[model samples]
Target chain A: MEREVNAYKCRKCGTLHYPFRMVCKNCRANDYFEFDIEPLPKRGKLLTFTFIHNLPAQFEVARLGLGIVELENGIRVTGQVDIEDPTLGMDVVGNVEVVRHDTYDDRYGFVFRAA
Target chain B: MRDVYIIGIGITTFTRLEYPLSEIAAYASMGALKDAGVTDVDYVLVANMGSARINNQSALASAVVDTLSLTPAGAVRIENGPASGASAIKEGFMAVASGMHDTVLVVGAERMREVNNLEATDFVATLTHPMAEYIYGVTLPGHAAMFTRLYMEKYGVTERHLAMVGVKNQNNAMLNKDAHLHQKITMDGILDSPEAFTNNPWVAEPIRFFDCCPVSDGGAALILASKEVAEASGKPMIRITGIGQATDTLAVHERPEPTDLMAVRIAAQRAYEMAGITAADIDVAELHDAFTILEIAESEEVGFFEKGTGHLALERGETAIDGKMPINPSGGLKGKGHPVGATGVAQVHEIVVQLRGDAGERQVKDARTGLACNFGGFGNNVVVSTYARED
Candidate 1:
């Protein structure tokens, strides 16, 4: 599993976007630079969450918790959360791990855990 | 622009039908042609999504037109995610309005049940952002769950409110023979009973099984004609008074405020302006309710109520069939079923039926002006249309 996630920052407007964008939405600039984010903080707050019982065939888990976590950088990203009971605004921290494995390869993604 | 009117409309029952995709479209088209008492049209527009991927079929318009024996007429397909139906209707409206075609036939169909539920879910997930949302396995219900969570925190909308919408629409569907869900669901059976948890499990957090629309297979068709052609048919004049469409960012996180549906607002505003009317003037409306929360959010976004107060209107029974201003009287996507591409045209079909006083038990009394909102891609692409009966 990758230890850190990658993001792109638009050089002109200082907008940080994950999964990258060619043009800056704010300033319409085409300049950007890629950088690996430091390990997510040990603690963050959950914006909202859902317990997904019905999942795609690729994910073997019977049920999974998915939520949007607001990192200290104020960037919100959708990730799987490892929590038995999750409440809005609950503190969570990023845990880089293998989320699933398909016929091809093991897939790694972020799963937030209660601090 | 010349005035356009709906000469006829037809829809198939929204359920699993073991038929070819082209056959579904052809069936609905034939019904509409018979309703209009016309054997030929100047053009044909087919609205479909996932035909190539799920059904392994392309050139859907040509197949449908040929099957309907409407060959030699200009035919094309429209794919706009889930909003394809309304988009094609808008195109038909333009064709008639611009004098390009005196009569146009618009048909929306989808055979999503060709695949299993899992494959169907994954196929629909393609509408999400490839890298940001889809990569992390985000589905429509997941997005709606988060959106519902935020809406609840901001507006005090509880689970009861969501259940209310589900029960209301599902019950309303009892009166609609063509609706997909025939089993009547009540708050007690699906919500308050001891077996409720098992009866309605969570598909995504905050969004339960009942909160979602069934993946349906169906088709709906409408006949659009210029005023002269429509008048000659001796049918009730249901004029296409307004059309408005707007788009938003491909990714949901990019929006300045994730909670605000700007596309819906802009599209509805433009439609109202073009129609020379306001929200208060609508006697009935068919807002896309793929998720129960959407009916509430769209009601406010379309100016039916103030922001954060749509649930209040629901609490007051104002959105019921007998309410002051009825919404989703045809049971909406919740009960009527959502065949993706067919949903938008089905919405129009329901509104036209209501406006014509042919909606039977579900008819909105004294209905004259109606509105239809066809939402696509989680509020990214929205189409709002207004219709009025000319006495």
Candidate 2:
């Protein structure tokens, strides 16, 4: 089975990184490890946003919405958003849903939703 | 100090082709040699900015040398992000000027169309901090959009301002046979383009699809020779009066003002100091317009206009071919097509054409002095070169 996606906390700096990193940027240490993968908070506010009209075939269904959101932990992360209005400093949050399922390929990604 | 002169230049039409990267370099090199009237080249400097991302291959210089069958010639590849072409030119200029070689060839090429759009974007994101910016999915357009917002909010330059830049460059590109997107642009087309307007959509808040340069595959080359060799060859020479390079922090947040590209200013000042001339003395110029806002921002940074006035100057027709100071007569990166590494060398080629009064229809009238600027990775690295037509 494919591994579930989750945030990995830096052992040295307590910073959380999506995807993954070999080293913590803040502490400059090679101690990127997580004991238990916890679901990230799905509700937050939008820091800034852009409406991407032209996108690759995968993202063409709906215009791509790129946004930076402040997580409940005060961590700012950039991700895809499905919100209508992209006003600055708007409330946004992450949703634990498959953004797009490549049926033939079978891959999924996390996307953001306005709370 | 020994003097260096660029005697010849050549560029292939920017297009999507099935040719290998090395093959493209060979074609451009041969054209440059023909332009220089040289049978033997002492050294070759290769510039390719995105081969690794496009093909998962690196070390393009050796491939070029083997393809060209230039045995025992010194060969090196240079990378300065998008400014790879100008960076290679600087290396070749220094090599000849320092008496390391009598004649040197600088060629810049890239094949981005070979990859899919997502792959290309991913490749460019490698230029940023992998852990910080790339993981955040910060695309190049995002950076330009951020700059556009800052310029608009701070200087009152609007989307209309950027569109005007597109309109002028597209019109000029129509005159350039070598340009990639040669179709003329109207202000309405820029403002109301299907891909940029309400029906079309926006990419980043301020920048739209039309505001960006094309992902093109092309090659451009220039031959540099010592003053003695250039004069003895009996070929027309475009003197390289000065070349200066400077770098700033890579991250956008690190800068004091994201809208102002200070590296361009410092580099241009150094070039002017060496060439003993100011921006006003330049009759023609080719600036890296990877995005519309880049042209305006770099122009202001290079002291071509007062801050926030670059858009006004473009609207006033001061930057057209017939204007007092013509910029990007080659259609700029927007219209001429930007192949990353090829852009800087192409800029120099356009300057040579302008200085020799050989640009044909788009020639800047009485262009005696010309300047070219190329910036890499959102103004992090910059190269400024000055050229003069010797009487």
* Candidate topping lDDT: 1
**Chain A (alone) TM-scores for all candidate structures:** 0.83, 0.71
Residue A14 displacement in candidate 1 (angstroms): 2.7
Error of 1 at B331 (Å): 0.9
Query: What TM-score goes with each of the models?
Result: 0.95, 0.83
lDDT per residue for candidate 1 within A4-111, as digits (tens), equals 655666666566775566776667874443332334443578888877777788877887788877777777777888899988898888876676665787666678
Residues B1-391 of candidate 2: C-alpha lDDT, one tens digit per residue: 6889988788899878588888888888889889888868899999987776676678898888888888679899898898889899989988988898999999999888898766676577578644334444467887777668767777888888888888888788999998999777676665765644753246666787678888888899999999888998777777899888898866654454556788899999999999999988999999988889988888887778998888889888888899977889899999999888888998998998888888899989889999999988878899999999885
Q: How do the candidates score on chain B by TM-score?
A: 0.99, 0.97
**Which candidate number maximizes TM-score?**
1
B13-55, model 1: which lDDT tens digit per residue? 9999899999999888888888998999999999998999999
Model 2 lDDT tens row, A1-115: 5333466676656766553556665576754353335555666776556665544444435456666566776555556667776666677656544443333643444467766
Candidate 1 - CAPRI tier?
medium
